[model samples]
Target: MTRSPIITVSRGRFSSTATQVLEQVRTARLASRDEIAAATGLSIATVGRTAALLVERGLLRERPDLARPGVTGRPGVPVEIDADGYLVIGVHIGRRIATVALGDLTGRVLASTTVRRPLGADPDLVQLSREAATLLGSCPGRVPLAAGLVAPWREIDLLPREREAELHDLTGLPARTGDHISAVAAAEFLHRRQGRSEAGGLTLYLYARDTFGWSVAVDRGVQTDVTRAASLTHFPTGADVPCSCGRTGCLAAAVDVLPDAARARILGATAGSVRDMLSPDQVVLVGQAFTGDPALRDVIVEAYAASTALADPVPVSFTRFGSDIQAISACTVALGPVLDDPLACVELTGVAAACRRPVA
Candidate 1:
């Protein structure tokens, strides 16, 4: 039961009105034209027109069976996400595991599989790509339109350009890659699905897997370009540990050797530093380190106290996921196109506007 990430683009190449309507329908899961109009504050006529256009774009589908009986000339048919029409392929390659899953337009997982790997070792791309192929081939309904590749920000630097180009060739679908933690943070900000509070201003997102990393989310999106000035990984942990980079001491190395309390304190210090420099409105904790262990939760709570002690305090909470959060984020990337928020596409608002015009 991997939970899908909720995604919302502020402005898409598609009709913002159409995007709004589709977002409403997705949020509601199912809705009639009247309901869409009410939710989006658009005219009923506008809803009908936008929805029809969305259907034409394959982002929506009409459900006549959901229409109520005893309606006048024609009851407005309820529409739901056409989950069966398009599929997203999500790939998350981590030090511990490599995963692949398929999702629909609404980001619902249809099927998934994973393979374990050596911790902190480079992934077997052939094996990972093979698994991804198998998953796509086995999906019962819907056609996969795109693929999303997710890994630690550091992994991006390690992958070769030739290997990167081959991914598109391997999948035969458009593909996207991004920082794993940032993807989750973006999803948290957009959908607020994990029961987290509304995101605004600077948000501190921290996580630990086989490695540790953090990102900043501002105004409902993760800022993927934080430098050493804003990164938590650069904080001094006051411990001399041998780092894999051949450095004498680094925060990443020290954390593994330190106790939970010490690690929390370091995290708190990092949070406090981030607050002083960035002034985030909230703190979001993700990854297995935060939620997988109750003791870590206590450590984080304690760390939160220490971090905010000297700076402006903000709300802090761990994101709870019903399924593998990373896999879902990866899937969200592929689902972006069908959801009308692809990472890249041409704007066609003028075309959409023309479609709304009545034929002579």
Candidate 2:
């Protein structure tokens, strides 16, 4: 049993003990005070006090039947996330489309809307901010704790720091920004209510859409910082095609000549390069190419085989999320500060990999 450590919660916030206790309850789905104490290494009395505080905050609920008498013969009730009282908003900014969604405290998407906008081309931060605010306003859910915006790192980095404040002002809620790939990874890790993702150990994420890109994670956390200019758009693909970057035979340019299946294979091969560089335990392919097209999915598997021609090839899988992955993930990233404890939760899960922590 891993002993949960009491971590310092920031000032003017929930106490360290209460935060850790609530996290244990959320992670376990439901837990009695004794279970939380056992998992977190806090005293039963401490867990009881903290649980009381969490319950008062509407963050947790007590299960009367699960209650058992403690050493003093007082009933100890099990608690779980309230799930109905809190919400998060996520915005996914893509080259061809943008989306805004509302999610519950359990990370379930409750309402969402899609708008056609070329975010990758000429990004109008002001317009996009207004659109996101409007979309969020139209949705029905609990008031969101915060809103998260996700775009390609290249595109997001172009926005000045003041852009976050502008977004908040328009949306009337705190707002945060992150790379699309990292947002996808966070959604995969934090919102796995149905089943666990096959992504474990060092994992590689292959993304295909308006641009060719990828990101890496170990254990559920992104391996790179949001400020890192990571991209695979220009990697050579040995083709004679002209690229938008004025280069011939580039990966992004190969789309004109290669079939979807071939493109999937090339993506798999590119994933292999990451595997060689980091030796990940698994590779996950996300986006429309893998999930929407069956032929392309099979082709990507073949590509994975060809790419890992060497000994000890890593396994590969695909995300079950549909088109809304980016939007839902952005919400998770926005809620990351609360869901994913920087030092305590990471240390408990044993993933300690680094990325930009959420502000809210």
lDDT of each: 0.62, 0.61
Give each model a TM-score: 0.74, 0.77
Candidate 1 structure, TM-score to reference:
0.74
Error of 1 at 308 (Å): 1.8
lDDT of prediction 1: 0.62
Candidate 1, residue 192: how far the Cα is off, in Å: 1.8
lDDT of 1 by residue, 268-308 (tens): 56555555565677777776756766666767677667756
Tens digits of per-residue lDDT, candidate 2, 137-223, equal: 665434456666767746444552355566677666556666777667656644442233132455566776665676665442212
Prediction 2 TM-score vs. true: 0.77
Best by TM-score: 2
Off by over 4 Å in 2: 1-15, 65-76, 119-141, 192-200, 220-229, 340-360
Task: Name model 1 segments beyond 4 Å from true.
Answer: 1-17, 34-43, 56-58, 62-78, 117-126, 153-156, 159-164, 193-201, 220-231, 240-249, 309-312, 341-360
